[model samples]
Target: MFKNIKNDLPASIVVFFVALPLCLGIALASGAPLFSGVIAGIVGGVVVGGLSGSKLGVSGPAAGLAAIVLTAIATLGSYENFLVAVVLGGIIQIIFGFLKAGVIGYYFPSSVIKGMLTGIGIIIILKQIPNFFGYDEESAWDLEFFEIDGGNTFSELIKMFSNINPGAALIGFLSLAIILFWDIVLSKKAKIFKVIQGPFIAVVAGIIFFTLTLGNETLSIASKHMVSVPIPEDLSSFVGQFSFPNFSVIFQHEVWIVAFTIALVASLETLLSVEACDKLDPDKNVTPTNRELLAQGTGNIISGLIGGLPITQVIVRSSANVQSGGKTKLSTILHGLLLLISVILIPTLLNKIPLAVLASILLVVGYKLAKPALFKQMYKLGWKQFVPFIVTVVGIVFTDLLSGIGLGLLVGIVVILLKSYQNSHFLHIEDNSNGKHKIKMTLAEEVTFFNKGAILKELDNLPSDSYLQIDLIKTRYLDNDIIEILEDFLYKAKERNIDIKLISKRGTVENPESFINFFKEKPKSNISLS
Candidate 1:
């Protein structure tokens, strides 16, 4: 891991800047103390990164869990009680890892996964708009359709337009310009440009801009748009802020349910991030999902025990890590350490950094994830890909992270089922020497009830007076409902004067109504012969 320290250091700096606001935002979303998000970030980067199987994946408080965490906190009655659930959730994740349930990541369609990434990218961009204009009435962490302050993302935008902080707007525009210039212009100039990463440069510039703005009391920018870190008088006082979990809630059924919910959602998000990170890795190294779960579980357990929010393999931060050219796990670890050191050693300095500057960094990251080219590429892949991708993007924009992805996944599954029903089986036809056309109806090898509609449609469309040869020779399994389907088709065939031949392990039969009868005489097993 130390081998890539030169590259990783620069990358870590970029991830640090990107992670700062997100940590605070997610904490705000979870209804936890803002410091809890930072605590999770520290644990995610230091503990989880140290134990991670993934070389490039970064872990942190995820937006995906924002809704669940919010609901869990509200229902649990106390934040301390919620911490109990978080720790238990971590334990549950550890069990999941041991059970080797990580394979769930492999089952998602690639198209839908891409849609998820793009959808998140759009959300990041949308969420940052208010911050960019210095509208601190809401934090970047707000992901709901309507915020606690009321109105949706669009309403916030309108509000931002009516009341723009000139200082913040100026800093935001300058920060964005500097980032864009470095990313598009200077980065191409030389290897030194690459060595000094764009995000790092953007942040330094933002700090300098903030410092310049500081001396001017007439400046409209309030300190709210700046990075806010909890400033304690001393180390002992800072440590006093940490809260412990109320283990008394451990016996509550609702607490367990919340724990289970967190475990399930956190584990799923980690699995998805693992899949996505593997795709993003330049070397294409696949992360061991079970080990990733273990790493995350350990991180969450540590985080909760120490008064941190739950952690997951966060795609936004990980993608930012990768885009910033992070080459190993060291980058992720170092960034966590940076968060720890900065908050402790120089929180006042951190507070001086403008929120617009952070927004600029995220704006760049978001643009990279949801580039216009991505939209065109998905469109070119056809509606099968485009519809789900757009739906996910819109859903995430309108609703929240998980809901949009769920909508996209639902649409994607329907597409798959529709395709399956449309092409239930592969059919071949030929004419025999007797001048009878032999229609060889071969059921799919693993026919399920889902295929019944298609099979019935095809059978119903068969021409009358045809010689039908039903072949289940290679079929290993068939649902009983399909057998009843065959029985009904047989009655219709008898009326059409069609000749029928059924072939299976039971051997060939010219016409067997006894075998193809109603559900009463149907075979007990799902797979039947003849």
Candidate 2:
């Protein structure tokens, strides 16, 4: 970890810039105290980052949990009581880690996971459009398709055009240009460009632009469009920012319910992010899911104790870290430290940076996540993989993150079932020298009820006066429904004057009186025809 400090340090600064607005924006969106968001960011970075087995995955207050936090806080009656739920939720997540529930992350299809990354990328670009134009109605961190301020995604974009601030638009375009040039042209020219990230340059330019345009009526950006970090007046007031949970609420049934809800949701979101981060990792490093859950549980416990929103491994910050050249957990830890120090020492200076500039940085991140090449790549993989991938992207764009993933997963499952049904048997039909049809049906390795329909259709469609051979040489397990189908087909075979040949390890039977009786007479587990 220490060996990559040169790369990690610079990457951490970029992640720090990305995380700051997000921390504040998510908190504002959740209706939680502004400081609580910063606290979550601090704990997510330092504590979770320290314990995590992942080298590149970063943790923070997630926008995915904003709606849940808002509802829980209001339902719990007070923020202090809500803290109790958050602590308990952490405990539950630790239990989940111990129980090895992390395997759930592996069950998600690759298509859905990739869709999630792309979906989030598209959301980031869409949400940041308003900020980029200096339309400050919504928080820069809000990722939902529908705004909490009572507008939809497209509506906000429409409004931003009419309400664009020339100062912000100019700075945003300039910052974006600098970022593009640094990444595409300057970075390739020398090693120094790699060490000094484009985002940092963009931020500095935003601040300078803000300062120079202070008095110009046509170009000056408003305070509303600038970064806002809560500045403590003095030592006592700083301490006042921290809030303790009400332990008495632990006995309340509702508290436990809320705790379980947060644990389940936070654990799921964290696992999804862990998978996505590993996918984004240039080295393709696999993260230990169970350990990640434990780390997140610990972070949430600490965050809640100090009045913060629940934490999860966030894809936004993690992707930013990877894209900015983060090499290890050191980048994650350093970013947390920056969040802590900046809020304490230079918050006033931090607030001077324009949100439009930050939006420009995120726009690049978004574009990378949802690049056009990825869509074409998925399409080339065939519809089985492509449908889920496309559905996940569309669902996420129209709905929220989790809902989109669920929809995609559901589609993927249906696809799997359809394939299973189609592949359950191999049917080969040949015309015998006597002009009668010779039909041979080979059962799949494992035949379940899903295959019953297809098997029945083939049996029913067999031409009359034909010889049919039912082969079960390689079958390991046969469902009862398929056996019943064959049994019922025996009568039909006799009615059509069709001859039947049943082949199994038990030996061949020609025109068996009953299919079920033959199988019951010699029930061998490893029955296979030679």
Candidate 3:
């Protein structure tokens, strides 16, 4: 993890810059104290990063949990009561880790995973447009297509045209241009440019821009459009920000329910993010999913106890880490430490950063994730892969994260079933020089009941008085339903005056007495002749 200080250290700074405003934004959206989000961000980066097996994944307060946190706070009667649920949720997640529930992450199809990445990438770009244009009414982490304020994702874009702040846009454009130049030309020419990442420079430029144009009416960036960190007065005031869980509410049924819900949702999100991060990794590092759950659970427990929102592995921070050249868990941990130190020592300086600068950084991240080349590559992979991929992308664009994934998964399953139903047996006709109409049918390997309809229809279409050969040489495990169908075709062969021959690994049978008696110990039941 420490091998690449040159890469990991710079990446950590970029990730910290990205994670900061997100923590504040998600906390605001969740209706929790602003510091709670920072708390989660700190614990996620330091504790989870220290414990996690992922090379690049960064954990933090998630936007997906905002609605849940909001409702749970109200339902549980108070924020303190919700803290009990969060703690309980952490315990439940640890139990889930022990139970090896992380394997569920592997069940997602590749197309769906790709779709999720693309969908999230598009969502990031769409959500940041408001911030880039200085529409402070919207937060950075609101990922849902439908807005709580009656407008939706597209509606906000429409509204942004009328609300663009000239100063923020100008700064944002320059920041983006600087980042692109650093990434495209400067980094390759000099090693220093790589160590001092483009995002960091962009953010510095934004801050400097804000400082220089402060007195001008047309060019001054509004305070509302800047990063909003909670500024504590002194040591005592800083200590006053941390909130403890209300252990008194631990016995309440509602608290337990909320805890279970949080545990389940957080675990799922962590598992998925870990998988997605593994896919995004330049080194192609594979994370131990079970270990990731345990780490996340521990982080959540600590975060909940210390007045933070529930934590999960988040794609945004993880993607930022990867795009910024992070190579190991050190970047993840360092980002958390940076958050903690900055909050305590230089929060006022941190708040001076313009949100548009951060938006430009995310815009770059989004473009890489959803590049047009990926779409072309997926399309070339065929409809089976492309349909689910596109569906997931579209779903996330119009709906929330989970809903989009669910829809894509459902569609992927259907595509699998359809392919199975359509492919049963291949037909090859030998040259009938003797005019005997010799036809050969080769059954596919592991013929299941799903292939019954196609096989049956093929058998029914055979012409009268033809010589037929059934080839099971490639079949490994034929289902009982398919076996029965083949058996019934025997009687039909006699009625049509067709000569039937069955070929298998055992031997060839001419006018086989019964398929039931042929190979007493067959696949799906007895020994394989393989």
Candidate 4:
């Protein structure tokens, strides 16, 4: 795991910078104690990363669960009670692994996964716009409904234009500029700059700028615009901030509902991340989805017990992990350790960092995830893939993350079923010298219940007195429903005095007892018509 330490260290720094604000943002959004977010980040990186089989995937307190966490807390009457749900959620996920439920990840279409990533990329960009401009409303964390401040995301943007903080906006732009230059210019000049990473540089600049402004009382950056983790004067004070579960609610129905919600949502997010991360991975490694579920279940249980929000393998963090040169799980592990140590030993320094700087960092991360090239590549893959991809992107942009993907997946499955029904079986007719429409019904290689509608429709439309040739030479298995459809069609043909020829390896019998006995007496398993 440590073999790629040289390459991994730079990646770890990138992930650390990327994860810092999200940890805070998600916690802030979920209405959890700020320190709990950091704890989750630490546990995600150190504990989860250590056990996860995925090489490039990063785990953290997911923004996807922020709304759920908030509702759970409100519904349960306390955050401590909510923590019990989280712990239980983790245990449920662990059971999911043992039950071999992780294969659920495999069923997601690749197009949907790409759409999700692209959609998330768009959300990240949108969400960070406020933070980037230094419009740090405490309500920004509530990303779902119109804010308690009487504005949705769009309204907030309009408000940002009117209430922009010159100091925060200036710092954010400058940090972004630094990051852009570091990636585009300075990094090319030397190996050292490349190793240092652009996000790290931007963060350092943010801190220095904030520190320098502190001395000048005439000009200052606001406290809300700075990193907001609590700064404890001593170890005991920091430890005191940790909130544990109130296991007293263990038997409550509401607790189970919250637990299931966390488990289901966290698992879904993890699966989606795994799929998207695989697409982003340069190595094209196929992560074992079941193992990933188990890993996540274990991580969530640990995170929940320790007062952290539910954990999931997050694409934003993982994508940043990949783009930053993280080559192994070690970078992820190191990143968590850093979060733990930084919060405990260096909260003072962390508190000094500016949120605008981290926003700048995320701004870059979001851009990378939703690059113009990604859109172009999807468009190039053709409309079959592109339509769903765009639907997903648009869905996410218009609706929420899961809803958008659900829309896209719905479209994708419709397309699949259409293709399947169209390909099920068909009758091709040719004129024969016997003054009849010589009909040949060619069956699909494998017919299932889904093909029944198409088969019945086609057979019912056959013309009277037509010489029909029923062919099953290429068919491997004819489902029972389809077999009945054919039998009924033969009866109809008899009533119309239409000549019917049955063709199969078994025999050339025109009318046989039911569809099954007709094909059964031929041979076992590999039945074929001579």
Best by TM-score: 2
Reference-based lDDT, residue 299, model 3: 92
Candidate 4 lDDT, 280-370, residue by residue in tens: 9998888887788788888888887878888999998999888887889999999998887787778778877777888787778788878
Of 3 and 4, the candidate ahead on lDDT is 3
Q: Count clashes in each candidate, considering only residues at least 3 apart in sequence or on different chains.
A: 0, 0, 0, 5
User: What TM-score against the true fold does each predicted structure earn?
Assistant: 0.93, 0.97, 0.95, 0.92
Candidate 3 residue-wise lDDT at 28: 90
Candidates 2 and 4 compared by lDDT, better number: 2
**Between candidates 1 and 4, which one is better according to lDDT?**
1
Q: lDDT of all the models against the reference? A: 0.84, 0.90, 0.90, 0.82
Tens digits of lDDT, candidate 1, 64-85 = 7887888888999988999999
Q: Which of candidates 1 and 3 reaches a greater lDDT?
A: 3
Tell me, by lDDT, which candidate is best: 2
Model 2 stretches astray by more than 4 angstroms: 137-139, 521-530
Candidate 4 ranges beyond 4 A from true positions: 137-150, 215-219, 495-497, 512-530
Which residue pairs of candidate 2 clash?
none
Candidate 3 per-residue C-alpha lDDT over 303-363 given as tens digits, one digit per residue, 9 for 90 to 100: 9898999999999999999999999899999999999999999998888899999999999
Instruction: List model 2 lDDT by residue over 1-530, tens digit each.
Output: 79999899999999999999999999998889989999999999999999999999989999989999899899999999999999999999999999999999999999999999999999999989889999953555777788777888988888887899999999999999999999999999999999999999999999999999998999999898999898899989989999899998799999999999999989999999999999999899999999999999999999999999899999999999999999999999999999999999999999899999999999999999999999999999999999999999999998998999999999999998999889999999876758678989888888888888888888888889898988887887777677778888888888997888887666677856755677665444333333
- Residue pairs clashing, model 3: none
Backbone clash tally for model 1? 0
What lDDT score goes with residue 466 in model 3?
86
Off by over 4 Å in 3: 431-436, 511-513, 519-530
